[model samples]
Target: MTLTRRTLLLGLGAVTLSACADTAPVSSLATTGLPADLRPTPNAAYDAWVASFRSRAEGQGISQSTLNAAFRGTGYLPGVVRRDRNQTEFTRTLEDYLAITASDERISKGRAAFDRHRSTLNAVEARYGVPANIVTAIWGLESFYGERRGDVPVISATSTLAFDGRRGAFFERQLVEALRILQSGDVTPANMTGSWAGAMGHTQFIPTSYQTFAVDFTGDGRRDIWSDDPSDSLASTAAYLSRNGWQSGQSWGREAEDGALQPQPGGPRFAVTRNFRVIKTYNNSDSYAIGVGHLADRIAGGGPLRGSFPPDQFGLTKDDRIELQRRLTARGFDTGGADGVIGNNTRAAITAYQTNEGLAATGDPSPELLRRLGG
Candidate 1:
């Protein structure tokens, strides 16, 4: 989910269909020279749509002052429309998914973050039944532990998507909820930021989700998930799991000697429990749940999986892929740290090396390519 925001829907057991193939950061106009499409642009149709939406909002209990304040500097963002229209679903293998979600970097960072916020996480776990590591893993997955909480303005994003009419009804509801949040004064219009699709805060809660699950763990009056301190967001996640039936003192799942729950054909098998299903309420993907479970295990000083995946579609084993990456990097092409997962960076590096060797640049690894790279 690196390219796109994690699909953290509020629906407990309902499936979320939206997917994005790529999701680069949308720069803030205040912080950087905004891209033309990302910046707010004038649109007569959008203004007219907002004019119509105002009445419906007021009908739904949005005060006039709240509406006026919410949409003050908000307008159509063409980038939001582009993102909504361009989403395409692509599934990564469970092995690759784990590699990205629970990579060495993420594991190290999760441990550090856990240590730094041990007291807060423990308190949150004590209050809610969800364990601290599970909460920490969700934070790591949602926004890279808050490092990439996005910079898009919530009002502008949801409003633009609502007016676009692809999934207008859903986003319109989100826009209304965002306005209600503004009215509650948890955050201000200027400070209300999120992803292009309007997922917000440290845990990437959509507006409705935030309204339902966000908490004020700091004991302030507001459920402030947008603050630098991650207490509220973390507690909110724990609360969501606890409410959704997270069984205290149970494993989310585990890598078993053998089981029927292998996500990939020749990958490591898992024997999951009821708590694993509870983790799915957050993102609703087996790989995501497993990633969180496994990462939580790792953050608690557990080792990697005991079982192994056979090989990738390219007929390359994890060791072979890692060797290929090392060979490529040795020859002046960087594969972004020899992770066995073949991501965009590895593919780009392969393409560059193939081009240099005057071979067809399919960017797909093969035994021949590995041999050429001195594997």
Candidate 2:
């Protein structure tokens, strides 16, 4: 259940295999090695999947009409599983990931979204005791303020994942909950598109999360987190955090001033509160948690990073820095075998390179030094 790279890959593989299974004819089921680009259309695949779900949902107390209405014509979305599979590659570096998701463009857009939905956000804040900016920042980070709410069919994605048998039981529960969402009239399946992993809405609630925390802030008798009105989604996120122990007054963490402190030796210094650790439970990466926490702070009007980051040692790009470690190891420089992470061995390699070249020995990788290494 830990959200590691291996788990992510397993989830994606499930999605790729299962999304259109119900729609595919029994005759075609025997066909092996289908092209990656092949997919079931909304018309052909949607009803069959819905029919199978409807029977089970009705047995579980979901109304027949509700299931019928919700699941009509939903399709497997293009590029959703592919995108999920490639998420790590896209955000390979913390700096690059932050530059995109926490960029001026996203921040400015988030502020505008905040202003536009101030009333709802404020109401949720008042009710939940969670700040509006934190809620909005989660919204921005999860789905770009609902502008990119994903196009993958939640039922299809979850069902596919569940049947794939990798993490079958976990995803099976999520699949059931997704059907329940439809039966409850919260959202139509066609409109229930989300990440390939089945996380949905502005705040990216998976089906189990939706069952636990989704709210009905609009008072329409439905926990409509997927709609254009962000009230429910925002409220749901606040509820989630509150239930998981989000502190009202504490900060997540702050950037350390010291560049000499490597994550390998001392790890990134973080003055983390209990709530900050709770945020990491959402996605178990320190860099991801830091990015969300920092972005949340910026959205709440905090200033830029207060520390100086030492330039990468060796004349190396981020990728080059990692590659240099690999090349150095090949040349018996013992740069600690490339891990795409800079550490003591890589630092020592840079120091040795500097010593040999009669350059200032800072033990950091710089672009100039990388060129000398033919990087």
Candidate 3:
């Protein structure tokens, strides 16, 4: 299963990561829930589990008052189970990946977010030693600049996952942390919402991650990642990166400018610096970090990639795609506009041409095929 890391911190998918090498311990349970202890874990029922958990919380030094409010009206959500079970593996080419993650629209939006919060970002940079653009790139990827932080109630989701017992131990801990967050009064249970796996806030930090890395950057005493202001979330994200050892002047590799654009696994990766490695700590996927880096570069007005990706499973470059499209169009095949993005129409045209040429009609594009087409 793919790990669901909170983007503000590396989505560990319940995987534990300490930006500071250790999650900070909550010293006092917030003074919010029930005044006295609640009864046992509910019998085989999700409600029962929560009840038992409330008692457990009381044992953990949480007050009855905190448990009462935190668990009230909370119940299991089956959708969280479904989401937890599903994880799509990486299959897209780097070009295709960038096309989606760092699309023109996202780049434009990221640039504006960078511009809109220039002073805050600058302060974060000065203090944390992480580049402002890198942090902003992560923001764009995680919640689309806070446009879509998941809407699931964190308590309900964590309790459900905990009760479900698949990753029971992990979820149970998160459930406790969610309660602590409430007890501390950083936010109400209503506002303690996040992804099904419980990654919350602007940067998708899971509950444990929040305790570990979240900071009250607004100086409001609460690290408010969910509020509309986003000062805390933005600052908190920077703090996470900084703690992960983000080198002050490092670049997260780049598209290989070296002519051979083998697109399948992506052209070539620069041997990745310490900062680049730290980016991996967040998502642990090369493509993911690459996407963040490229997108950040684009948002900063950096030029389009100098090298078009090399031959994918289908062979070679933007020019090749357009030329192939043009050639096929000339030969009575409608390959659509010479747009470098080769979707089905282009594939079908190639298949048809191959069949007429007495060749194997695999339908995949190749440089050799382009040469034969005089493209």
Candidate 4:
């Protein structure tokens, strides 16, 4: 999800593989009298990569001065590489995920923040169509309301990931976009800090996403999402959801009144609606969208789910369901959408896919299937 920029919110303790990791900030790079050509990379091999990249950047129309300013003192981040390589996948029931993402503490804080920013939230909603409570819920979830917007230097993180080469082409693209962000003068290198994967600011937008979706709601001439003030960040988040088809006045979802797990007449499944699909654009996990919905509903003075899910059923978390859908989709089996909430479409896709691949046609998605599918 962060790859699409949704994963940027992962790593708030129990939610890492589900999304952003907490990290430190990068140091300033504003030394006076510094010459760009004189900057040296930490490793000789990395230096060679930097040199090779310089030509590619130049071909992309990035000026040497801009490149120099961006890369000065830039080096590989071993920690970034280590974290990326060691990402762990774990399971948590829907209830368990909500316990952490929408805890009472978070809900209380969300209400307080929503009250404090009521006027701004109102104006943003008018312009962008995203409701106040939903925006505040994402705010609380993303960084505890700007308390932790990540600290890893953007350039260092991207450079390290690009140099490490596990997903070199992808990281290299990100690194270039990062350099472009620096060259545009949005923020100085000293100020361009974020997660190791280059997700920056209050809403944790990857550079490309920032370029496409960030807005200067404050009219301050800059889309500043990193400052102590969160107006731009909040507005930008609204913009993201709205542009992605957020329906005004429509709730994300509601729990079944009876907590029934029965299928739609014939088989076991719960078909998600259009709005539920919109929420998935944020994190692509049924649990994430549902968490945001439930948390926002709570912040709006709404009550808890009238029903509950059997935690041990399926032995998979919302994240796992999403991964299964992803694998199924990758193998050319369409599950309609990979929102992690299995429906008739998903079961049929699994059954057909299993049959084609010579596996049991049980129609059940499992860790074993995911392992075989190589997600």
| TM-score of each predicted structure versus truth | 0.91, 0.67, 0.74, 0.71
Candidate 2 C-alpha lDDT tens digits along 1-375: 275211343232212223223333412322123234324334334345445655665777767555444334333434443544456443234544555567777778887888898898888888887788878887887778888775556765665555444566776677677777777778765567666677777777788778888888889999987778888889988888788788887767676744332333323444666666767666666666766777777777776555423334333444666677776676667886654456677778878867877989888765655666773
After superposition, which runs of candidate 1 have C-alpha atoms over 4 Å from their true positions?
1-34
Q: Give the Å error, residue 48, model 1.
A: 0.6
Worst 10 residues of 4 by lDDT: 12-21
For 193-237, candidate 1 gives per-residue lDDT tens digits of 877788888888888878888888898899998889999999999
Per-residue lDDT of 142 in model 4: 77
Decide which is better by TM-score, 1 or 2: 1
Question: Which pairs, if any, clash in model 4?
Answer: 1-7, 2-7, 9-20, 10-19, 10-20, 11-20, 24-151, 24-152, 25-151
| Candidate achieving the largest lDDT | 1
Overall lDDT per candidate, in order of appearance: 0.81, 0.63, 0.70, 0.70
Model 2 scores what on Cα lDDT? 0.63
Q: Candidate 2: lDDT of 63?
A: 77
Model 4's number of clashes is 9
- Angstrom error of the Cα, residue 374, model 4: value is 45
Cα-lDDT of candidate 3 = 0.70
